[model samples]
Target: MKWGENVKKEIGQKIKELRLAKELTLKDLSEKADLSIGFLSQVERGMASLTVASLEKIAQVLEVDLAFFFTLPQKHEANIMRSYGQEVFSVEESKYFYRLASDLEGKSLEPVLIHLLPNQGREEISPYSHQGEEFVYVLEGILTVFMGDEEYKLNPGDSMHIFSSLPHEWANFTKKLVKVLCVRTPGIFQGDKG
Candidate 1:
């Protein structure tokens, strides 16, 4: 399935489960999620896309982790690493690229191995803050990393580490793909505490 489609379906299912688990009516859950009843209904019906911000808000209201929406139920050892050929999430759309660097189960960190294609670089946007610490190791090409007002240029083998409470963004500065290994500690999802 397409990544977007799969995500949408999973989001719907997760939302439904959370609502049921909380024993909430549609109106009650909508009020808690701070979303319109109709909109939340559509999302639960697999008829809408939940933005990352929206998903986070819903997770907050549900007393769950945002990553809870991404995890697939499974029994596995902790801190496991999959080889290059074993990656479970990799998607290339026209404008961006994404990959999951770690399995979303009993995790203390959320690692995203990303490759930003040239020509898709974004401007210096405001920093976005979350809950923990962030570390990024550049694997290939050049990348511009922004930590609040400071901007650092990172090349292959270089790394940047900062508190997640600080705002940050990145840009691809080379013609080639900019690959980065990003690790966010304390995980972005609530249940990811470890």
Candidate 2:
């Protein structure tokens, strides 16, 4: 399967599982998410494209952070996560780049390095929603954050604590590169907690 399609199917499955685990019927979820049942069914079946906004609504209704959908079950043995040899990865739906900073399986905290290229816009980024808290520190250049329609700009050495339940997006609408260190909770969903 193609990366985008595969990822969509994975996310669809996760959504379905969460909804069922919560004992919510399709109609219940559709109403709570303010989405049509047919549309939600199509998404769960991986037969439709899911926009970030729509996903945020569903995630909010499902009571899971956006990271829960993107995370695959991986068991990591090493506790020390070195920058060297760490592969740069990304969600296909979003143009932003990412590097996993904390890889210990089942850890309470998940740290990530986010890189936004120059001139990137909200359309190129994915919206995020979760029930966790996030701490972000600007490492390089300027980072533009949109938290539930509130816009904020952060420069080097600037930091912010974000309530993850709010739908959020990040952009770098400048000529310079942007890098940020982000740490959040409720990650590593299927592993033994630390």
Candidate 3:
């Protein structure tokens, strides 16, 4: 799916607004997110797109939900139905596309649809762990889950339940785009410190 420039700009603006509201400078956010100031500046200017992982880091530093970047400021209702045409964002420095499946505030669970690009898997950066549990179902292509020292390969219709505290990561080893439905308890998409 092609991501629109307008959506990228809007998400960037939202992130900038949140940063300003938190009285954080670009350097501060950059340091907190382990990104460079130049990259963060580009992100704020809508000149760059962030991967799901990068956005999660920013949300954590800003103390907001990943959905906050995708959503407009409004009164959130208890129930929400997002259509297929909803915006999808690319991850920073990765070929991943993700859309927030639900944006309800204070929800105990967070669901996301992730499209992992072919031949892309975990980055060389240190693995990250957090306090929660994750459930992933392969919707298309193949997914390789790296949980600490173990690796699990999953095909379409395959699923896995993993403790989020284990330093885990994911990648797509095929030549086609891989799609997965991922849900996390305690909302890993929200203010995660990892």
The candidate scoring highest on TM-score is 3
| Off by more than 4 A, model 2 | 1-3, 13-26, 36-42, 45-77, 84-92, 95-106, 117-130, 147-149, 163-168, 174-177, 188-194
lDDT scores for all predictions?
0.68, 0.71, 0.74
TM-score of each: 0.62, 0.63, 0.71
In candidate 3, the residue pairs with backbone N, CA or C atoms under 3 Å apart (3 or more residues apart, or in different chains) clash, namely 50-91, 50-92, 51-91, 51-92
Q: Is candidate 2 or 3 superior in TM-score?
A: 3
Give the number of the best model, judged by lDDT.
3
What lDDT is obtained when candidate 1 is compared to the true structure?
0.68
Model 2 per-residue lDDT tens digits across residues 44-119: 9887766556776787788765567775434343675555545554443334444464454546777777676677
Give a tens-digit lDDT track for model 1, residues 1-194.
Answer: 23477767777988899889989888998887678999998889877766455676678788887757775434244555445433343222211333354356555667767777675435323345667788999988888888888888998999988887787767775678888888778754434364
Worst 10 residues of 1 by lDDT: 90-99
At residue 171, what lDDT does model 2 achieve? 78
Residue pairs with backbone atoms closer than 3 Å in model 1 (clashes): 65-190
Could you give me the TM-score of model 2 versus the true structure? 0.63
The local lDDT score (0 to 100) that residue 3 gets in candidate 1 is 48
